[model samples]
Target: MSEPILSLEAVETDIAQYHILKGVSLSVPRGQVTMLLGRNGVGKTTTMRTIMGLLRNKAGQIRFDGAEISGELASSRCRAGIGFVPEDMGIFSALTVEENMILAAVSGAPDRARLDWLFTVFPPLKTFWKAPAGTLSGGQKQMLSIARAMIEDRKLYLIDEPTKGLAPAIVSTMVGALRELKRQGASILMVEQNFAVARALGDHCVVMDDGRATWSGAMADLATDHALQERLMGLSMEAG
Candidate 1:
């Protein structure tokens, strides 16, 4: 296997008095989607935040593109080619969709070619170009969040629980957009609760429990192993 583009080695993080991530370690290979899976309260989001520098790690090292970024500020990391889509979608409620996308662009305006492609990927973004982001439906907000991250070229994307609470049809649209992202060679480390979406987009998998990785392998392996899924995730594929 090739070297990972992003790596976390024994990363430890705490929130106030609570220890959320304990010795978390994982790798995101170049040009592939690596799914981070876990039940609620299992530190999956914490791990993503640590990578983004939203939460500082109390211990261990974070390496991106072969350099240590453990102490880098979130802005610095973002400038160095890391994009983040937080769990809450992070769109400016008061801003128009066009304004949000414009702000996300590094050059103060989105590149026409890329913006056109993004519109193709999520058509509603084009339809609601002038609408306030707060007025968009939940699924549309999620699409806007992802579209914002794609406004610029990035080495990796750290997305948290993108499919949460979406209707099945909307989830399917999200799955299609993500699949297109993969084809376009975007490296992603995503925390997703929806197994079907995970299985569709994940090239590799990391299963977390109680703030640590309990299993790691190809998504294909995890997808077929109902027994292993039950052991690591506390539910079978059928139940998922």
Candidate 2:
């Protein structure tokens, strides 16, 4: 669409001597959640790491808001509005929920309206504001991680396995929060193994296999294509 906010053209990444992402190409359209799905160990996390400059791309290009960002350092990428929430959720264990949120505060005063918006989306975080992050449950910790990311004024967010270890109810809450992020015009690239959660939050979808993109289309199309689902994701609603 409207000039993708982020574009990865033939991106290749390696960990030591191993080539993990072999010529993967994808684009994150502005204001949409582009779900990157694949079985475990399929280079999904590597893709996110490469985008954030945590890992360098051996080949191809990465462009952010129309400018090439492939060669930038991790901090440079962060400064360029690329926010990331790793699978570990990266919350400081000793810090209180409010302290964790404050650590992400930038030049601006952490956008009071955005913090309020996050509170509306994740009520559990609001309740745990004064508690230590280490004391919160897995789901609550995840909410704090997401809230910290939103405290920064970033245009793009790269989130990995956001619903991994939560209860079904909390998973639904996470889905709703991500949907609201899209409504607020934030572009998201999410790597998810939970198909139902992906379908609920994604507008576009890409399935990666063997370190490369094997399928890409609108999420609605993928939903109805049972054959494609089995072949690519090895999943379907009936089987689950």
* Top-TM-score structure, candidate number: 1
How many backbone clashes does every candidate have? Answer: 0, 0
> Relative to the true structure, how large is the alpha-carbon lDDT of every model?
0.92, 0.88
**What would you estimate as the lDDT of candidate 1?**
0.92
Model 1: weakest 10-residue lDDT segment is 231-240
lDDT per residue, candidate 2, 44-83, as tens digits? 9999999999999999999999999988998888777888
Query: 43, model 1: CA deviation in Å?
Result: 0.3
Backbone steric clashes in candidate 1, count: 0
TM-score of each: 0.98, 0.95
What does candidate 1's lDDT look like per residue over 1-240, in tens digits? Answer: 778999999999999999998899889999999999988999999999999999999999999999999999998999899999999999999999999999988656789999999999899999999999999999999999999998998999998998999999889888898898899899999999888888889999999999998889999999999999888988976756
Q: What are the RMSDs of all candidates, in order? A: 1.0, 1.5
Off by over 4 Å in 1: none
